[model samples]
Target: MPSMHRKRNKSLGLLELIAIALGGMIGGGIFSVLGISVSMVGVFTPIAFVLGGLLALLAAYSYVKLALYYRDEGATYSFYKKTFPKSRLVASIVGWWVTFGYISTLALYAYTFASYAISGFEFANSEIARKAVAGLIIFIFTLINVWSVKGMGKIEDLMVYTKLIILVIISFVLINNSNTTIPKILHNHEDINILSIVIVASLTFVAYEGFQLVINAVKEMENPRKNIPRAIYSSIFITTLVYAIISIGAILAIPFENIIQNQEYALASGAGEVLGNIGAELVIIGALLATSSAISGTLFGSSRLISVIANDGYFPKFLTKRKNNIPVYSIITMAILTFCLILSGNLVVILEFGSVTFLLVSLLMAYTNFKIRKHTHSSLIVTLLSAIGLMSGTVAILYFEAITKVEQVYYIGGLYIILTIFAFIFSYKRN
Candidate 1:
């Protein structure tokens, strides 16, 4: 077999690839979703975390096959375009939706970062202060990404590993301080059903969305076929364990209402109660590190994706400009859009949008993999099951929106329509 290694001026190794995925996955996702998951299903939040990991694994199956087959830095858009070259519409839809998906997540991570960063201050919950801080962090990371990818990767490694250690320690401390056990909590709560767990698990899919960041870094990585799957799977598994442990600790130690009330910074607040100022401070530090790296990683990989799409002519050609192999304009564009979203300051809606977009995109990816399963040597049954899993996630989100926030469903629907229109216009112009 020919070596899959590609000689380049610089390359990222298996560890770095894993860092990118972990950095992306561990961002505001856990911080933001922990409270909601716990509220929806108290003692079983850890179970939901494991189920979420399973769903992520299923999604990664198709992404790994497509990444190996195409080896295109474009990732989602590139995979779909190459798979169905004749359909400009398909390319356009995937391109716009996926790019915007990253943008929404960027906004999310920054917002979550702001929440934690300001949590120590008297004005922590102040909306204006939070948005201002969020915008600042986004600008700071955009500059860091523009400076260099290697530099960004190093920072990501430092932050990701450090936070993982902090998270594990905090989990242990919280669990030890708890007066209750999982069995006690479970036995006391009889109303929690399997269906509720499944629903929350589906919602947890957003937490696992970052594994694909590895694929987006194909151009910078060594032996992608081996490293891509290794990095993605390993990161997801590690993340699952981290999430499960911490979530169990939080649920066990803190009252459910406290978690729900301080949903944005639940862990930190709960830790304060369980372990006093030191414990709260420790969780805050972990969150700050987690969200910080996430913002950096998302900007680093997604900017490259934007450049790839622009170069393909689906987006403005001027966005293809690069300096020292950096997509400066693309990075700026993403940062500005993300800042705007932060200014809007609709956390739940933004979270729902990001999760829904990725779920739909993953579903499409599964179908694409199934279409060329023979060439990719993919398992027919697994690909089909992946589609089903992704579909169930989409359904779960839509159902939640319909019952609690019907207006958000309409808002998301309207945004999709607008995105589809832009995709069609650009794709048609390519002719």
Candidate 2:
């Protein structure tokens, strides 16, 4: 409620809150996902993003309501735990799944950061170099987070705002130099159907995953009642708009083959081919800023969630320890796990895992809101719609992975089994 600019404040204002949410949402999201989306539905990429954003917005409805009622910085896990205090097993399971989902997203962001950060170098293609940069950036942001919340917020504000300006410039330049018209592209891809677009949109749920990070900062921000909904909704709307414009520009200007071939760094590579070095470098810069701030915001918020869950006996107790109220152990532990994920998995798997994890976790959150609809003052119709939409998104994603990458479906099932075992053990101990 108070201005953070009044000489070093303890609380985050609306601007810093929006910066954190936007930072997480935009970072590595569009940059890494563009090519895959284009490959799936061609010129319908922006339409998919818009539809995916609607899913995100629908999910945000419950998040905002629960955040205000519970007012807990713990967010997803806390909401479920509080809503179903008697079901320790369910609560513990949700805790593990949601927490690890954030970890995977953090890994995805860090890995994306490394890819673009070294794109111009000869060693950029070297696996070792990319992993090293990923680890290094995670370490750097970990230090920033452990140092101070205010410091991290300030740095996030800079990166987020600067990237927005650069994205606008990139969008304008790309559209101005367009090589194809929307109608013409659509004619060529007339076979693409609504089911494919919806599936593609579900594939994009990962990009919209970070809006809930705003609720993670509830304890540090002022006026949760007002800022909570404002920050989350505003960030989602803005991020969707930015992603649409950028996707439109890329689809119209860059060749589809180029985008598909250069999947890892499509925007940067395509921009380079179109506008030469300057355009490419601009995209690389935007990618760097996006992932950097995303890494910062994800680590900052997820650590707090971890600490809270640890205190509730679902995680390692050591994670609950904090240095100067910063959850240093949780932050460092998450960074280490994230780096391990980066080392273990390739880019595509990491991205899909993050998206799938978030989709499942958000569905649970929507279910939580539906359970407490009356108490949270939520509309029955909206709650049902949110749950239905999230369920459809989840089924859509799993269907895609099942049909295309059946092995990944097994891999995801294996992960859930392992997580459920841990959740069971933790719940048993708590009982």
Candidate 3:
């Protein structure tokens, strides 16, 4: 991975890089988070999405600066280690935090994939059925990724582009067929406040996370200084538009009660009542494609990160071994943990856990970028604001969890405690 220029006969261009970012970001984004956002913010859902996008762009600014300076595919973990070389414990902790964050997202995508894939079935709401389907999808993607990296890339290209079109059409069709206007929605939900909307925005941070996957391709792309910013910024901008449009359409067309009731498959259930079967079918297809590609891309990218960490001796050495250039142990280990997360929590719990994990991790990245702003050519104000925004987002999530479901926060806190213990032991052994 060191000789990045010698990656392939043809390095990734801006278009392919954008496709990867969009694929990663869009996959588990709208389809998974929309219902929850709507539930929390009512007619203000699009506003939350816009706020979330702004936060994403802020986080991206720091990521791009660090990426241009480092140019390593190890990405978040690698950047942190290089920035604070002597702080082995913090670096080891960051590696663990980021890797587990990916696992939670993999679980999020698979959970959404199952919800939409079986939305039309008799057992759609069955907990057992949902988990079984989620696990099955994970199994299928795991096999595809390990069998051939080239094959996985091609499938990714197809799904990424096709899902975008489907999602656009679904959003337009929903808005065109809306039963109520935004004004009426506003009149009914007049009590909603800015703080609530911002909380939802913070909780929805997980949806914008895949943009970092672009930096993970540093070794596969050209001109890191140029392409990293271009690809990540462009993808997030485009995705923000996509999400805001979808949020507008969803709130306009889908009844809040129905969306809240069917939270997991909100679009599927509501699209059916609003536009009949044709619209529902469109949403299901788009969601399946979105989540499928997301699961594949995440598993592929995160496994490589695991391989890097294990090679650094933070994890079991066997995870660094590969067969046919595939990190088989790392990939399988991630999938199993993803299923475990799904089994342990419901949709909201998983979503909150993932949202909090990524925000904290990105916050750490922002702090690291600020610590060496001169070397990264980063501005003082932008880096400070980025850290502040990420910190606020993390605090907002904890506040939301504490307000709505206090026990959920304890569960998430316990999980972090376990991860911290693992990170400590790993870093201690290295000493």
TM-score of each: 0.97, 0.97, 0.96
Candidate 3 lDDT at 262 equals 90
Off-target runs (Cα >4 Å) in candidate 3 are 1-11
Worst 10 residues of 2 by lDDT: 1-10
Candidate 2 stretches with Cα past 4 Å from truth are 1-10
Q: How do the residues 1-431 of candidate 1 rate in per-residue lDDT, one tens digit apiece?
A: 12433434246888888888888888856897898888888888899989989999999999999999999888888888999999898889999999888888888888888888888789988999989989999999999999887888888889999999999999899888887877788887889998788888877677788898898888788778788889999999999989988888888889888999988888888888889999999988999899898888888888889999999888999889999778999999999989987776477777888889999999999999999999999999999999999999889878878898898889888888988999999989998
Q: Candidate 3, residues 11-52: lDDT per residue as tens digits?
A: 566776777788778877898988888888899999999999
Q: lDDT of all the models against the reference?
A: 0.87, 0.89, 0.88
Per-residue lDDT over 230-263 for candidate 2, one digit per residue giving the tens place of the 0 to 100 score: 9999999999999999999999999999999878
lDDT ranking from best candidate downward: 2, 3, 1
The stretch of ten residues in a row with the least summed lDDT in candidate 1 is: 1-10
